[model samples]
Target chain A: MNDVTGMPQTAVVIGGGSDIALATLRLLAKRRLRAVVLLGRSAEALNEAAEQLRGAGVEEVTTEIFDVNDFSHASEVAEETVARLGTVDLVLVAAGFLGDASLEVIDPESVAHMIATNFTGPAAAMTAFSQRLLRQGFGRIVVLSSVAGVRVRRSNFVYGSAKAGLDGFAQGLDDALVKTGLSVMIVRPGFVHSKMTLGLKAAPMSTTPEAVAGAIVKGLESGASVVWAPSSLMWVFGILVHLPRRLWRLVPG
Target chain B: MIPGDTDAFVGWGNNNATRAVHRRPRNTKEIAALLEGSSMCIARGLGRAYGDAAQCAGGTVIDCTGLSEILAFDGSSGVVRVEAGCSLDQLSRYSVSRGWFVPVTPGTAFVTIGGAVAADVHGKNHHREGSIAGYIEELCLVTPDGPRIVGPDRDPELFWATCGGMGLTGVITEVALRLMPIATSYLSVDTDRARDLDACMEMLASGDERYRYSVAWIDAGTRGRALGRAVITRGDHARVEALAGTQRSIPLTYNPVQRLSVPFTPPVSMVNALTLPVFNSLWYHRAPKHRTDEIQTMSAFFYPLDMLRDWNRLYGPRGFTQYQMVVPFGQEHVVRYTIERLQEASCPSTLGVLKRFGAGDPAPLSFPMPGWTLALDIPLGSPSLAVALDDCDRHVAGAGGRVYLAKDGRMRPELMREMYPRIDQFLETCHRTDPDGLFVSDLSRRIGLTPTTPTQRKGMKP
Candidate 1:
């Protein structure tokens, strides 16, 4: 359950190995988070993250093998996890793939994999969790979206489009669950420096994983449906999204 | 018009407003109709509860206030059968003039009879009279299964469950309550000022038994040697002979009206850190050090805050949360520890009240017990308010105490089982009464009161 400050006591991270998810869980542990269940495709990474969370003061930390692409078992895993935890205050969807856009444009197989990892798989998992959460009566879901999805750019249209699909899905889910004691929050970071973007050129307003985690924590406390990493990205995208396509393409990454 | 109107509803605290479909059912037939088709629903009265106990998010909120009719009243026997919507204010206006009053009332009279029953509200007289559950003879409940009458003797399981069930069992349509007979609408009161926590507790423990009603106003701002300094007030219904000069002619007069109201919410809380200490000091110092045999109106003694309509808005747009908890007789130290922790966290509380509760009834979820209960109103603006309250909850639960569900908007689900040891029994009764799980409220869902597994209802489908 979430406390008076809306800080979740127990959380389930779908992509437990994601840098931002681990950082957010660490920060939440400092703010009264007691238990967590980390689910990911890699058993070793999930176990490592669970150990780190336990060390950070989370009383209970468990790991489960989860492959988002296996849509058949998504709902089953959600039910099992909820049964194990008794009540989950939060379910964070932080799984995504940033494929090489240059090669993905021509590689149909890679494109399918990217779309499955970034959009379809996470959506399936969230939908399943939503059913369980609605039945249990109260819980929140936070999905890691991106500013890139706010307006798909020429540089990374494939990854941006996948995130765009997820952003729209989450927004619609939030509205559908209105007054149901269930909510969905979307986090849009301009550019987060993490394992996924280690050698990438830093965007103009790029932020660190810890900053993004801080914003997510604050967003949860404020009951915000959408949060921007630097917060200024809300306005930056307000104008950038409306720019002429020719000019939008010319804007640097 | 099936679901009635769609609007935002909030508890008295004015926080966490949820948009719900509101239905005003005029009779049991209509209520039964609403219950049959709705996936989830809960009855709402005057919304006096400070938290989410009354509001069901995204679900149907049957506004029982429409059923505001006094069906039967035997003035001689001091018993009244009223529609669940009938507010205590209305009941008092009708009954007090006829030498009768509600057996139990919280700080306010605006709450409905059904709400009083649902929360099993207790007044300052709880030390002697117990909660409203003791006075509730029967109730007309409309559940998904259908409408039926329940009482202490008939369907006692369901009756006790509904007492403090937080409206999870079903929608209450009517209540048969036993009122208290009174000679006049005035109280012979006494006041005493205590210098510290021990003195206040000692005075209450030693002298409270002599009075029918007792409560203490603790100054939370005071710390160190002066910590928990309080002004205690104790009283009993004044006899007609105690009335002064002209008042004797019509001693039962009960025309209590709102003297002042907060017209609108201010931009910032009026009861903030800057002004709270000043208010506390003035409130503490203004009281008579020791006074006795003072004739006071019943309204003045019982519901002074009722004189100011929407007084909750004084906390401003962010609103405030009332932390009310009860620890058993031997666990009085938790009361002082809570105040100390609040002060240490710099959480300025505007109002602090202390009362002693007698042995609790059979209701598993009922709040009061043979213990000391303290209630404090803290503005939501305090940064450490949540942590401080959580810390208090841990200690209170460790001491076998529980916070009042009617006043709780924020509490962890894990601690609920620890706080209310019989919560599983209450849930079992809820499941048996409404197996489909049609009745629910935001508070129920937030605290994990709703059934967690589908397996719990496997063999019970009738």
Candidate 2:
């Protein structure tokens, strides 16, 4: 009944309550992924997300309290989830922040918080999970990287900078997993329409969590190194990333 | 815990949009979990049902599209096990490439297998084959109690009940279907022009069995002596040797390119009273008076509408209603009367199709029987459209015919009971399987099916 890769039967979703994370989980479940461990900040949101996953036909869903800002606990979270789910075949990390861009200029603590929430803690969790996957000798990891991180825009530089660091971390991790029976796929989505961006004016080529989920699943199925939601954004950002400093500053967030 | 997005959903016909909580279940466990938790919910696949059969107002609507996957395919036997959410279009293209085809398919290939099973849909080949239910080897359904595998020989009542059950019996998760083997992806067709209703009926009655598939396109706008003028077409799969030229090299390649599309819904419908006669006249004359062994792609023969994606938007924002009904062979006058009534009512229906169904399946609520089935796609801008359709309903019921539940939106409960003589039996079976009335849809409620009452709810849930 399983597809070519035998359809991943176990998975772990970091930042599980986030729209893109939950969407990716649903896509995985469709591929017959049986067991999942959801790690998220809000207990209420995690419970609701687990219920939703159950409705979407995931056989077993376990949620644990997690905060991406809690850097010291990141590795523990990964270890515990892996121990609980057992032999996780897929790990999807969609933990990040889109905090006020101006906060970096006003306070150092705010800048640190943004970096910890978006980069440090998530990177720690991925590092822990990556080691476990290598020991198991077969697994896939998908991390949600934003187009904003492709080339940090001044309007949201603080948030973009953290994603920039995480994006680079994912790329390095992907290279390190070469031929190790493990793989990493970094998803770059531009202006996603989600609860986090509800009130914000939508940017051109804005995609949905479902769209990003589709890209991630397609990447996993094809064993692609990276995926871009609304794929055109890959080229758009490719050219935009190389723009001269003066011209790039004029570009909106 | 994962609450679904509550929104208004409309059928293919953009009419009767009802608010419901839409949950797309990725697996059977999720579907079962939703069924267990939701007070009321109905399983929907692709939302291709022309009316509200897939919608549950103020309740949960489980979107089964996420469950789409071809589990297994035996090319030798032409048997395929697929998730119910797999569309006929998907299966046809996949199987046809392997020298196999779905046993029965509706005009639009966009319909999901779950919808096809729930509706008991028939195709142009009904005279030779039967409805989709006949081809279904087994069905794995998530009932109120749990999962159950039902087949014709085992649990025949539940099997028949689930067929054309309109998602009332349960959420169909997996279906094992027996596919028809074909030599090529093209159809060798014979076309003939019928001058009137009698000529059309005569052609279908006498010549249908000669070919594997047959259907007629009646010009509903024609009146008086020309009433029911039609272009009758009969076809069979073109053998590899039949293709004389370049097509012989790759006989089984499926036609997948959809070259045309309607990007957006126009402010007003393109199909209206003013456009009917001109379009009908042009269409009727376009076909040759008589053509034999004309080769056409399977898409051209089975799914011409699919060529232009989102063609339904042509009916405009109000959308269109498909009134498909079947009248027994003895009551052929009802078909004629219904066509005349549409003409009098000034309801310009496009693509008025007439096909003869050969035999009825064991499914009690299945739509097809040994009869003449006429389907009409009438745009829904006219104020008198509902009344005219209801009037036709009575005429059909009087003739021992019934309106298709899949195509119904405004049918009365009493009339439905009258049309379906075995409603009591269908209800009794539903009670035994889904006594709690958890599997409810807008169509079921509108027609007084699975009425939530103290007696019905007895020994059901806390």
Candidate 3:
């Protein structure tokens, strides 16, 4: 059922992921939607996530190996999720880099591969998810963004630029699904110190993944076309995206 | 409330008197406007009825009586133009004065023309003139789609449906039927005392061939051999010349004093065993043993109760129920067993009538048939009553018979589905006519007549 028009209603979470996507999945299941197919890169990793969902009381889950960079297996994982379960209710594209920004300069190839895995691969995954959502005449595409995308803070423009493109694409798709009751909510988080950003300093009033999950649940309930993380960032970015060129160059990376 | 009828007894299952909201619309256009986007609905006539047939619970009810109007009449052809709301009593008074009468009339004159057509109400002469539908020439029904006139040669399915449609399809607005020509405004009558139930049925059916009107009044409380014993009254419209010289000079006027009701209810026990038995005995004893007499007026012969005002209140707090079921010819055992059970239970019945009908009109849902029909007037308040008769409905169904939709209340949806296989067809027509499901009624809701609501499709559930 992972074809263009249908996706497994079940979803599996790969990696020890953020709580936002899982919280969203649990909400969908409450409405009696079936199948939450979860796929992580490692057997143990997928098992741990499944255990956490079961502990969290999520009723439906499917898991398999799905490494973002492992192209051959990653595509197969998407196929197998649909095969085992059925059409998907939603696709949480919540897997990608909060990698070492400096590693890219030391190894250009790593930077290029990160860009490929971070942007290109997810784009391919989204293409597949979109086909399924449209065919079913319903679906939600939730992709995470970072405040870093607010401006290329040259320090992590590679990640920021990729989010910029993803954010733009998600918004356009949201517009397309207006009357169909389907939508996309690209969440842009401000800097925070997490496992993803181990050494990074927390920004002012920065929120935890718990806060982000709460925000996403509220947004979905309100049938919002889109939602911003730390909601104040919506206005902050509104100013940042149009900052004066001379002042923008002076802002810290 | 009629005797021994539990299904017709509970007009509102939730017997909150606050629920009785009497709506009065001014005219047919208002009714037409109400039909928009109806999910489901049934039309209601006068609340004079003792059952839910004319009382839809929570849906649109077009009070067709608001459209009551006498549009035209051709004295030469005996054809009358009237709104569906025109009452049988009103029509009778108007036409009978001018030498015309309805072809068929139920015991009461308070029923509307549309109600008559909807129930296809038969009369003592049903074995002769058939049901009211036979006299119906054309009907304008506000169908699922909109108002459309249906005649036999027109929308035949709808024509058949509207005759006994019970307002499920839509409100019936105007009707054009041929008024019957009468010899005079009087009836020459004959009364025969029936020895038993069989003799009662025999006397009623056999006398029907000779007389235009025939009915049997059973002494409801009498048991065993006397059970089902009745007085068969048969009559023919009397010409002015047939009346004795002096009696022919009597005036033709509406009775100012008809049924003087029992003022305030006498209490719940008023209609119970002892008193009803006494009353039944008195009624039976009071009838003339075997008399041939001249009846002064057609209304007296046909609609003796038309003179009554607020008669429904006679049933007290829990209104009376009219339990009428057909036990087709061969299944005489059901009728016999039923009467025996009623005898055992000692259910008090005041007015018990027995009549026979010819095969009913083609209106697929019409209730009258070529079988025996017995109706009783029971005072309300009996929980076990419905359960008992529903067993009777089941037995009747098993014997290839059915209860009238126009008089039903407690029937289950499954039974309705089994009995009227064409109900779905009626629903489909409603859907097409009112796509948004604007029309809905209490009876439809009570009987599993539900309309599908819009829900989010598949995933991304909203």
Candidate 4:
């Protein structure tokens, strides 16, 4: 059971509104692990996600109506998550988005604020939660990185750069958690045409939210540090992310 | 040539179907090495089984492949006293040269003799020799209580239980059995083609009594009229004088080359709809139509396909599930119905083996009865795989048929409980010998093969 990564005994998914995050909660519940705490801004979405996870097989899932962006109350949310869940082993940080990528071209302040919400918010939330795991001497976290972070093309540099920062943070947390019996899985999904991608044109190597969710579970179970959507996109991004900035700019949109 | 107590553990033969890499103990004392606060252990033979029949799953598995020294053989009585590790095929080749052979063998001669006795295995000869249980004269078993020799006449209850206890009872170290006298190594085989699944069942059931071994290869992919097209094969050993010039050239002392590991995993599509169709076509065409021919070597006659090593891997990452179920004699229609349903669902199966049983010998949890059983291998693909098979399990149980324990992994405990009525009794013996559940297998955990959970028999009496 110790070898089992992630929070099997109790899990807290911070972005319950995200379908992929809710899917993870549901799967963990189905595995008969108790005390699932869904933390998100929308109480309705958190309650709905918790109910879905319970109905799917998670015998116990509680709702915590709190936003990750509220850094002042992040420690309180972590306490409530562990208090209700009893030894919360996992905290899935799945919040963040590509909110108005073109903003960097016109509004610099709005772009910075967007980056703070998408990257800084989750980083602060995770730091608050990680202390509890460090005290317990064991824990796992699944951080949602994005393919955009792998290569910040000019078309989406504003959103991509935020993910790039978050991705680096998750990797460092993963390295720091080692031998503490704590672990981190940074999932980098390519254009997962989910509810978030409703208006955007589907990217090449695009996959579904379900595929991303399934890959997250597989990666966590296999103790993989990182996972990419469409699976083959790992190699695709591996090469694309290393191209010279000028050469990267030449790639077709 | 062997010591008085040549530890009675079953060894791995050519069948590498177990997780011996997990635990390997040398003797009963050394075998006890894996107990780890557990009271007892079971000797695992060649893991040729399709399911948890060989594994203790969460417990220990002792590799017995090294215990295969054939201790002694009596020429006149055709009795071979061999270590548990010696296989039916090994015994056959060794005995046949001396004008003797193991009386009963499972379809795959790759199975060890200890496995034969433990499972009470039957073959094309089941209708005659009954089973390896009937031919088995004695079993030397080691329990937490220590080594005990049991036979039908010596310890009837323990004897019957150990016959099919799935290694839960104790370690079957050595087996003594009646070996059939053979004039030659070849079989005089005859092939008959059945038009459909129904025809195949009927043809095998009606005429299996006429030959020493009888089985049909079903083309599960066939639909409508061809839904069960099969090639039925039956044969008896060809006498030495009857052997042709070519067959006579094969010497009596020939040893088969052992199979090496699969060097590389082929692409996942190797056994897909397209490839399997071609393979099946080639296989069906290669059979000699209704020809009575003499074949050299039991390996070639009974295990020609064994040459293709790790054939199961051909199913790709979706590890293949082998479903072998036997229904009663009057229920050939039920067998046909099941096949029809599979065809209707368009479930791509790689293989289907159909055979007939003469009569049930009343081995408490014996899988076979007086009827037809069809074993099919389905590679896991869609989510429907489990649901589709659960339906098949219902149909089989409804027909008074049951899935072979050797091939089961994911059967529901409810179905298993209903299928094996004396399950409680089996557990009683398992606890009596292995108090700590040292022989738990993967199949046991999946199929709820252990003691019934409280929820299972909510209101029923214990």
Q: Model 2, range A1-253, lDDT digits (tens) per residue? A: 1112213567888888889989888876754466788888889988999999999989889999888767677767767776666456678898776777764464888888888888887898888888755544346788888888889988888888889999999999988876454567899999999988888878899999999887777665444678899899988988887899999999775
Q: Write the per-residue lDDT of candidate 2 for residues B249-331, one digit (tens) a residue.
A: 99898857789999999988999989988998898899889999999998899888889998889988667878899999999
Candidate 3 runs further than 4 Å off: A1-253, B1-23, B37-41, B246-259, B421-437, B449-462
- In order of the candidates, what TM-score does chain B achieve? 0.97, 0.96, 0.88, 0.87
Query: On a 0 to 100 scale, what is the lDDT of residue A91 in model 1?
Result: 97
Arranged by TM-score with the best first, the candidates are 1, 4, 2, 3
- lDDT for each residue of candidate 4 in B246-365, tens digit (9 for 90 to 100): 666653443555474455555563666677767776667787767876465677667766666665556553345577788777777777776777666666776688887767654566
The most accurate candidate by DockQ is 1
Name the runs in model 4 displaced over 4 angstroms: A1-253, B1-21, B36-43, B52-59, B245-263, B293-296, B316-318, B337-347, B381-384, B450-462
Query: Which has the higher lDDT value, candidate number 2 or candidate number 4?
Result: 2
Docking class of 3: incorrect
Report lDDT (CA) for all predictions. 0.87, 0.82, 0.63, 0.68
Q: How many backbone clashes does candidate 1 have?
A: 0
Error of 4 at B403 (Å): 1.7
In candidate 2, position A198 carries an lDDT of 80
* 10 residues in a row with least lDDT, candidate 2 chain A: A1-10
- Model 4 chain B weakest 10-residue run by lDDT: B8-17
Question: lDDT score of model 4?
Answer: 0.68
How would you class the docking of model 4? incorrect
Residue B175's lDDT in candidate 3? 88
